[model samples]
Target: MSFNPKDALDAVRDIATNAVEKASDIVENAADIIRGDIKGGTSAIVANSIDIATHAVDRTKEVFTGEDDDED
Candidate 1:
C-alpha cells in the first residue's frame, strides 16, 4: 500500500470544508448588518412622523384660538 493518494484526498477535503465554513460566516454577518440597518431606519421614520404630528396639532390650536388683540 502507498500513502500518497490517501493523503492527497484528505488534504483536498479539508480545504473544501474550510472554504464552506468561511462562506457561511460571511453570509450570516451580512444578514445581521442588513437587519440592523432596517430597524434603525424604521425608528427614525416613526420619530419624524411623531414630531410632525405634534407641530400640526399646535398649529391647529393656535388657529382656533385666534390672535386679535383689540377686542372690545
Candidate 2:
C-alpha cells in the first residue's frame, strides 16, 4: 500500500479540528459554572448585608427612644 501525503495531511487537520471543538465546549461549560457560582455568592452577600442593616437600624431606634417597650 502506498501512502499519499495530501491525504495524511487532511486527516491530521480533521483530528486537530475535532480536538479544538471539544476543548472549546469544555471551556464554555466551565465558564458557565463559574458564572453561576459567582452570582449565588453575590446574592448571598447582598442578603446578609440587608439583614445587618435592618438590625442596625432597629438597634439604633431602641437606643434613641429610651423606652422600655417590647415592640420593635
Best by lDDT: 2
Candidate 2 stretches greater than 4 Å from native: 35-72
Supply candidate 2's per-residue lDDT for 59. 45
Model 2: weakest 10-residue lDDT segment is 59-68
Write model 2 residue lDDT over 1-72, tens digit each, in one string.
355566556545654565565556555555655778666555555554565555545444444554324554
TM-scores, each model vs. reference: 0.40, 0.41
Q: Candidate 1 — which residues are off by over 4 angstroms?
A: 1-3, 36-72
Every candidate's lDDT: 0.52, 0.54
In terms of lDDT, the poorest run of 10 residues in model 1 is 61-70
